[model samples]
Target: MSLLSVLRAELAFGMTPLLDMASISVLEGERIGFIGRNGSGKSSLLAAMAGRLALDGGEVRRRDGLRVVLVEQEPALPLAASLRASLAARGGLRAADLEGDDWRSTARLQEFLQRFDLDGAIDPQQCSGGERKRAALALAFASQADILLLDEPTNHLDLDGIETLENLLIDEQRGQRAAIIITHDRRFLDRVATRIIELDRGALQSYPGNFAAYESRKALAMQSEALERRRFDRFWTQEEAWIRKGVEARRTRNEGRVRRLERLRAQREQRRERLGSVSMGVAPGERSGRMVAELEGVSKSFGVRAIVRDLSLRLMRGDRLALIGPNGAGKSTLLKLILGQIAPDAGTVRGGTRREIAFFDQQREALDPDKTLIETISPGSDWIEIGSSRKHVIAYLGEFLFPPRRTEAPVRTLSGGERNRLLLARLFARPANLLVLDEPTNDLDMETLELLEATLADYEGTLLLVSHDRRFLDNLATQCLVAEGNGLWKEYVGGYSDWLRQRAPPPRAEPTAAAEQDGEDGAGRQARPLAQRAAKLGFNERRELESLPGLIASLEQELAAMQERMARADYHRQGPEQIRSDRARSQQIEVLLEEKLRRWVELDARRPA
Candidate 1:
């Protein structure tokens, strides 16, 4: 039942080994989730399996007549072709060629197009990032291949799109097809993967279940290792004591014991080397005032597409905030606005006098492809000065899994995940009061993402994060900011899922009075839903809508002024009583503002067609 088998694979980037002595087999009906830290050769192995990349060592054996297709992050399509035409081209089934053969081909093409919300008439070139990703997925799902290899399939998918894709790729009736996916979406992996293949340190380990099961098994293995280590140490201690007893006048008869002692010492060192831990904890820098940053009446537009408008917000000490939106929805623009990198069309942005900000730009624009990894951190030096401590460049790079021997290699040769790790190392090395991260989770593996969450949790500085990783947000963010790109921003208290529930479309607005009278009895119509009762504001909704802009502006000004006052050195030194009172007042204003904003979105959704 085996579909493919990778036997004793060995791969290295230059002299830096990637996959070493790794072997894995792909069996029939297996949905394998390929996972590991960044730059662990997951992509390389996938390419090797598809015969796209030549393997440096080890042969890949496939079942005869196996049809394997690898779908990458970007859809490789004819730019000028219409969406429908592209699908036809990928499926190899022309409209005319499909005469009466299989109508299911046309039916499936239409279903996938609709699921992705793609307009068939539009050129693929004109689609947005998410749209292109969806189109690629739709094509992959429509292919005739028996084995599908997907890379970061959820990169640009929205929540609904993700679920729809989950249904398609991880169905209960998987038929004869099998798949392998590379993704950081924990939920997606758990829902789709029948097995987990982890590639790390040039080694491969296969777990027979999903991510959760893998964690459980790994924990148990660690527990067993701990016990074994203790036993080995105890036994080695006795042998060491005997060996240290001078070996009976250095006699040749003691050579066997001496060799046994050396072997035990080597074994201990090997274990320690395999279990080494890396610390990414931040160094305490200059503490900022209570108020970090504030924006008032902020608006930005690109060629009449209003990305943000009339937005106001305050950032206080220790604020871990996340910005959520679809691709191209101005999340990055908002980050720039906070940092004052670009002037908003109209707004006032204030940054604290002591604010020291560190930005992790998702675009990876800071990296120079021509520069070596070591040179990126220190121009010509072998160490970096972080606050009062000097960290060695080699050691620092090691923390991010960059081998010192590869220090001379250019940055362009690194994988997507490795680039992200390099960025993190460079950014976190500088002590800062605020950290602004844009899509930091894009190419990271689940392990790296969890480590990032841990680092952020331990960080004392304020955080502004823009990401689509739901797990990361729920763990690290204290508040959520939803940006809808049409000049709309909403703040929710909990994580992404909480925000989803808070915004779940209210049940179909009660039918019109005429429909209620004609379709139901008077008594049934009278028993209206409580949730609907508040939304049935004949003119109040409109009036509230009219006054919201001004009211929100007023509330923002009041809160910003108060927070700025409280940020003063003397004001913060005035003890906790005054601080509590000001926070209470600000919280009240925030609640009132959120309620009004929720009403605004509801009224907008209820607007007449």
Candidate 2:
């Protein structure tokens, strides 16, 4: 039986339809992902399902005795409560409810804290945004709701927290709990969801399979829609001409034919309206110099607690660096220091000779609430002048999917996602050679996130980004900077996964014969043999390791040449036969590059200290 069903629901704001005649049914034990663009009624739909929002016209039916919990993007918790106390309070379980004399409660709380990396026993009120998210997630999971509705639950979470949540949702031991997750996180969706449902034009439709499948289907659908739109345009243009001729002929019999043409034109307009487009414009800019930004012995501290210490890093043109760490590890602070928002206590910060950097903060707090979209994009110029006599503000707003009517709306009225889009539009409108983004994927739709990824990939500049979106990091980051103990920063040669693999615990060493002899003799005999082994690479492997870098560099140059040749190939002039050959060659090049890159990374990591 279906756990929940929405029948012909209609939700609107003023005269705008947020959702119209949307009906959906979710079965027990189903893991569904709710996806849509920003301001596309995803959150509203979830709210309606959870019965937190009134539906204008529809009925929500739930199975008898089913318990539902809706977790919002920003969870609410009492400010005074400690992390442990808050969890217990929201979980509605007394110490006795847990098995064994309060020990179980304590153990469970400690486990949750440790798993989330909040092991310090800090007050909940003192926790960072990411920590708060973890606490809320712990409480939500403990609730054991039969049906869970999550709206952007991963927004403030770090990579570790996100992984934890994914594991919790996918655990079979959790029983028959179903979930409706509204998220822009493609990776999270891929990991946790079994079904994909898209919200479009106030209606819901299920796409068979997971997030990846949905993306493939969505791309095909978009291409088909584009072709249909072109055909519709041609027909409408021809029919309009015919209707004009009939009206000029002054024939009474032609009146009915003209009316039919008018109806046809209206239908064409509706079809056009259904086609979604985001007008992103990339402004041209001078190429950045070799060095984008540099930091040497950078350190930051507050009240003797050093957040970032002795950090040294360099960003170059065409570099995509992902800054990663647990909450309060000073990932954002590093960005701020680089951007000159905060001054480091000790170190030198430098930028390229012609650097033009743009920073996108986590909250998008740079956007002004008192201003309109048009004003925000072009503050000093008249709308008419900037837009080439048609109001550039409107054009800019339109690029971010903001309607013409909403151009004059106050920024305060915009949703979090809308604000993010607007901020992006503003940033892209201005030329910059270096981009410093802090959590750019937060509040963004999946489509927008993909668009951003593609844009950054194609961008001929430097990018320093901090994001918990694993897919984004995988596709974009060429290097990684992990914040570690005592404000130390470690640079990894490759991406996030590479960092994880390298940081994994090394194999346990077997005790040496001398150590065993010492133990047998009841004396601490020889640390010398163990110390000597640690000081030197095993004699058999030392020479080969020294030559690995040179070998890897040679292979890399060949791979680069192959890539360049493929890029230069003229596929447009190729016949079907040639096209097949060209595709095969491209795939071969890609595989070779991947193989060489992996080998190079492995060789580099094995280098002697």
Candidate 3:
């Protein structure tokens, strides 16, 4: 049964058309992942479906008495109200109603707040961005709504928060509730979405299953579409040549052919070309000394809280390092210490010679909102130098997906993603041997994010990154410096996934009183599990470690085969029970593989030096 339908939706922004004869029917139990380029009116579409915005033409139909809730990109909460009161108002619960015997509503509210680690009595305005987002989500989930419209729900969330959301949505799919979510988190979509819907050129294209399935089908469809367009153009060109013939040939032209040619001309005029990918490149500066920075027994603290203690690290040239941790984990403080921007309390910080640095701050304080795009990139002069090449400011902005007309527009007029792109455009124009980016993937589209990844992979200079995006870290980081709580940092050999497999689980008991005393004195205690696992493996443990590789490989093979089957165009045509069983088995394999990998790492770490 269809819960909602958008019938021939026609919407426009001023003179530009955002949606043209677009239509889609959202059915029951459907978790749809909505994807598109930045500024493609995805948010507007969600608003229209939720009945918050009226369409210029066409209509939105909803099932009778169906409740729908929308979580905006920047959710607003009453400034004067506490978090609990804000959520209660959203659920339409008055003071008397909450005080009555409504156990279910009260339980639901407590469940979400506890799951999100939010204190209900706190002021909404005092919460951080991620906390605010969680509160908004909690409000939506506690409602009686059957459908949810989420816009960039993962923007400020950390890795753990993203996983929590994924699990919630997957559980929700088992119920009758449905959702239409707009996000750029690829891994989240892979784990949660039951279907994928793309908004391209003001039209909706539906594909069955997750993001991987859509990627495969979209590639083949684009190829076929391109071939057909080429053939059409060829025929159109022949008709144009015949119509341009001299007077004698024109008189002999068939009347039917002439009418058909006129129709083709109109079709060509109305065609909307697809936008191109972002073209990005880095300009390398003069080579620097091999060593970038080195820290010797560094310790930094703020008031009574220790941020970094007894930490030593050497950063070399050409190293791509990622700093991974939750928000407020001292990642920024560590980065500043490495860059020699601040003095350490009790250690030495050394800088490399001949190093030129370019930093992309997450706050984007470098961009002036009052300045035009042209002025921001190249003030006064129209031409800017990129390494050895010189290009006009307008053309440079074009490479970053900004149109010529918007070149003179102020920076404040651009959206969040656009502002990030503009920052990249400015960041890349300068020559630097060291690049430091803080949360660079926060608001980027998938296409732009992938392009940025590729560009960074090809860079010859050193890179120091801080981000909560697991996939981005997995793709680019050569090593990760993870926060191990209490100002202790550990270095993992690979990216975020590697850290997950190698990290020691939390201690089962509280630290000894002596250990706690030492921690308070700036000496953080290592977890007991690491010490317990340091001994040599026994015979049974050795045998188990030896068998892990074969078992892991077999499980991987099985999972790959299942994925290949699921990616087939006719995969959804199978019996519903069979599809469910296969999906269940695939998930089981993933869990088994993670366990095997963790065991292997643990045993290997126990081996003799």
- Native-to-model Cα distance after best TM-score fit, residue 339 in candidate 2, in Å: 4.4
Best-performing candidate as measured by lDDT: 3
* Candidate 1 segments whose C-alpha is farther than 4 A from its true place: 1-29, 53-65, 73-75, 78-80, 83-107, 120-131, 158-160, 201-203, 226-277, 346-348, 380-382, 506-609
| TM-scores for every candidate against the unseen true structure | 0.72, 0.74, 0.84
In model 2, what lDDT does residue 235 have? 79
Q: Cα lDDT for residue 587, model 2?
A: 36
Candidate 3 C-alpha lDDT tens digits along 148-192 = 999999988877788878878888667788999999887677778
lDDT of 2: 0.74
Error of 1 at 527 (Å): 25
Cα error of candidate 3 at position 609, Å = 30
- Clashing residue pairs, backbone N/CA/C < 3 A, model 1: 20-202
Question: lDDT tens string, model 1, 56-170?
Answer: 7898999999988787876676644587776677656574743444677766766678877777778877787788788877777766677899888888776668888888876
The per-model lDDT (C-alpha) reads: 0.78, 0.74, 0.86
Badly placed stretches (over 4 Å) of model 3 are 95-103, 246-253, 506-609
Q: Residue 559 in model 1: shift from native, Å?
A: 34
lDDT of 1: 0.78
Off by over 4 Å in 2: 79-114, 117-127, 172-174, 223-272, 297-300, 339-347, 383-391, 501-609
After TM-score superposition, what is the CA distance of residue 235 in candidate 1 from its true location, in Å? 7.2
